[model samples]
Target: MEIKVSLIISVFNGEKYLRECLDSVIRQTLKEIEVICLNDGSTDKSKEILAEYSKDSRFKIINQENIGLGASRNKGMELAKGEYIAFLDADDWLVDNALETAYNEAKNKNTDITMFQMINYKENTGEEKKNDWFNLDKFDKRFKDTVFNYQQTKEFLFHLSVSACQKIYKRSYLERINAKFPEGIYFEDAPFFFNIWLRANRISIIKEYLYYRRSHENSITAKCDEKFFDVIPSGEEFFKIFVETGNYEIYKEELINFAINAYRLTLNSITEDAVEEFYKRSKRQFKKIVNSPYIEDFKKYMSKGNQDTFNNVLNSKDYEEFKKLNVNSKGNF
Candidate 1:
């Protein structure tokens, strides 16, 4: 059977929600899909749960030592055999028609990429909310139901969500571009996302919310540990893509805005114990930006508020001084 979509689920100690995740795949309305589960050294019943689902001929499980989500995804891409590739976190599940709808849209439109909406599901409260980031209404009405590229939607570039799970890519397109997640990083999606969207020739969107993203304390996103620092290197790699592709100068302003916003969010989220180190590294990154050849452009495009924060970060002698300045400027610590 020709596989229309290869759904890769990266698992690591996700036993609690493993069944639901696997069940959703097996029950997908599209039967011509392959489920490739990368078990990244899960110590819990995750392996056993995968074994149970492996009975389905469409399901395949590959076991390996813990290499993190990014590497596992890359490995899954290598093993995938389908016209299109999709991703699913082991802790998340899909609506019954996700693959069917996304695959049909891509195939019919002959698009290089197809994106859909995601619903955030809170584990503790069982609250479900539509993720506004994926809302396509923000784009111009003319772009709807038609194939387009980043250049056409460049004005709303930063508005696009970076979550890999929210989209599907043509296997040939990904291979042609050598697309792969950045291994050993917490924000791998950022680099992978920027690379694809910036280069894709044809992209489409499905307004339906087909994926459910679970929110829990144990998730990497909820933690504020050493891994949070990974954002620095990730952001560096992200900007490098634009430079290598000669799109840096064209999208410089939007890119800088993205970096500033990302840094600010990270600063606010870092744990107290790690905040100092994060602040130091962030300051170094901002200094590099300030020293770049595009400093004038940065100054021209950056908002007054962001400029003040950037200067404060560079002028402060240390994290303490930065904190004091920040508290005074924002009226809070």
Candidate 2:
């Protein structure tokens, strides 16, 4: 039997880039694939485009209220009938033969998760220009002996930021761990990928750059809002889970570095309403981190940028220091 893959996408106000994204998927060299587009209450032509695409046999559209990316993904999971699952952002796309290459390799190797490289393209770029934006150098020898563990995976993530688009996962593994993207949240890919990496065994890697990620201005990562701070609580939840289950002392440094960097990012993006709440929550969280029994290990990864942010949080009174922090400023670092 031929292997089947489901390409799931969640969209909101994606009319501008919807067609291009869909076109890339339809043109993939991987023939036995299904395209499931979840319309999460887009107030634009996004729904119209989905309707138009529904005419294709492989296209399936689900209209849903604005339940956020997590819920949309979970809904897609429920509707998907494929053995292997792949995620794609509405604004991003895959290169030709991307899925065909990854799928064949993963199946042949009998691996649980398979990953590749991605190229980020700008909006105005033409087809040829878009393909040239990424660094395509392959890294075969370096990662050859790297074994998979929760700690090794965490360290690797420090270098390669967790992106949902760069990998294809098995549906059985996702189901085994009950790994659904959390509903009503931003940066929702965090807990999901963290869980997947730790759970996956027999993983395979491809050095090819197969995914094209578009860094659009209106993308979710571009919105530095109050909801951004929610990442702290969500991250804390992941840390606790990892520690309790793995008993791995190795993630301390990376965890601290991740937390500190995230703190700076959150503080720098705060609005008036987000300032007081962010200060209180983050201050408490940082204190917990610094006072933890493993403080010394955590300090090993204390980046200069994190230390500055922490000091600012400690010395300031009632959002004053936070107000002094740059919000969308140039060369603030």
Candidate 3:
């Protein structure tokens, strides 16, 4: 059978929902698809679950030591035989027609990337909420049912969702760009997603929520630790990519806004123990932003609240003073 889509899943001790994830792929309407499961040193019943699913011809499992999600995904991409590639977390499941619909849309438009929407599933309350961030029309009406390149949509660059799992890429396009996730990082998706879209000549959108992103305490995003600092390097990598590609001059304001938003999110999520170090790192990053050639543009583009936050970062001598400055303010801005 010809493989139209190769769904790559990196499993690492995801036994709780591994079966459901595998089942969703097995039940995909698109039968001409290959499921690549990278068992990244799963010690639990995950291996047995994968073994059970490996009975199917389309399901191939690669058992290897834990090399982190980014590296495992890179390995899966290297071995993928399908025309297009998609990623799914082992704890997340997909809608039955996800692959089929995305594949049809991608083929029909001859797009380098096909982006879609995702629903967040809360493990505690079983609540499902559609994340509107993926709704292209919300950013601009012209984006609806449109096939366009990065330059055409550059104005809304920062507004776009960076979740790699919410999109599918043409295998040839990925190979041409030598696209690979940043290994040994927690927020690798940001760089990978931005790099692809920036270089993609043609991209399409599927507004349908095709993927279910599980929200649980065990997930990496829920934890507040050193890994949260990974967002800093991830942001730097993408910013550097923009500069190297000569797009920085065109989207400096957007890129700076993206960095500010990322820094704020990190500040809000990180543990108290990480405050001092994170503050230092963020202050360094903000210093670069203020000292850049586009400092005037950054000032004009920044909101009053963000300006205050920026000033606090630059003026505060220590994290203690920084905390005190925003102790009563909402969002710590």
Candidate 4:
């Protein structure tokens, strides 16, 4: 059978759980699919595990030096022959029917992107946090098993976690929009997926949680290094893209909210001495974004909750209060 989907997993010394990850993909019901595993210069037995999986014709292995996650996934996208492409982290696994369920809906609706839900999988206890954005109560009734065009889905895009794994993109659609992850950046998904989401006319959402995002200490988001600040730049790159292309107001509320969140994360993750400088820099950015030519339009279009946040970001006293609220919510950024 011709390959209908190409699932890419980028690895960097992930031998410990690599077998389970590969097994999940190999056992997928979507038979017409290829598992593309990119070995990012692993110093461990990751290469060996990949070699064992290479025995299966459907497994495509690309062993390269550590070029980071963005570059590795970019290579996989360039080499993918399938009509649709999806991502899976080396440390994470699929839900057996993930590709099948996602592909069927995407192909049937001719969607540019099909997004499913992922539960945080706990490695030690094998328990999953089922309370997620995908939970039925959390989603609008109209969004369930539905297809949304660009304008219809614009607001929903902001709620997306920016994780490439929970989404499947049409190969041609990605090429048309030049949707690419920024190499060497820690938060490449913020800019990359936002760009893609803007260009997507048809995006489908599945209520079913078809992916498992493992929660482990080794994950990048779990770390609080200098790299944690990369999300600020990543968000800015796309914020400019929206403004330069005259698409700012169309997603102004989202862009502004994302900026505020980025500012909060930066403040929480940076050293004490760096906080003031970061705050000043972010304040300037906030001003630039909020001083939009369509600020009125943004206010009109923004949801109530967002409007309050937007107002607070612009106000010194209220913004300080907002910071206090987020004081205890550090470390996860």
Candidates sorted by TM-score, descending order? 1, 3, 2, 4
The sequence of per-residue lDDT tens digits that candidate 1 reaches over residues 1-333 is: 999999999999999999998888878899999999999999998888999988999999898899999999999999999999999999999999999999999999999999888888999999997645866555666767889887887778788889999998999999999998999989999999999998999998888889999999998888887789998889889989999888998998888878776667777778899988988898888888878886898788876567767777898999889878887775232
Per-residue C-alpha lDDT of model 4 across residues 281-305, encoded as one tens digit per residue: 5556667756756566656665544
Task: Locate the minimum summed-lDDT window of 10 residues in model 1.
Answer: 324-333
- The TM-scores, one per candidate, come to 0.95, 0.84, 0.91, 0.81
Distance (Å) between predicted and true CA of 284, model 1?
Answer: 2.5
Off by over 4 Å in 1: 330-333
lDDT, each prediction: 0.88, 0.75, 0.87, 0.78
Off by over 4 Å in 2: 1-3, 124-155, 269-277, 287-308, 321-333
When 1 and 4 are scored with TM-score, the better candidate is 1
Give the Å error, residue 286, model 4.
Answer: 7.4
RMSD of 4: 5.0
Per-residue CA lDDT of model 3 for 197-291, tens digit only, reads 88998998887889999999999887887787888889889988898788887887778777777777677678888867888988998888778
Candidate with maximal lDDT: 1
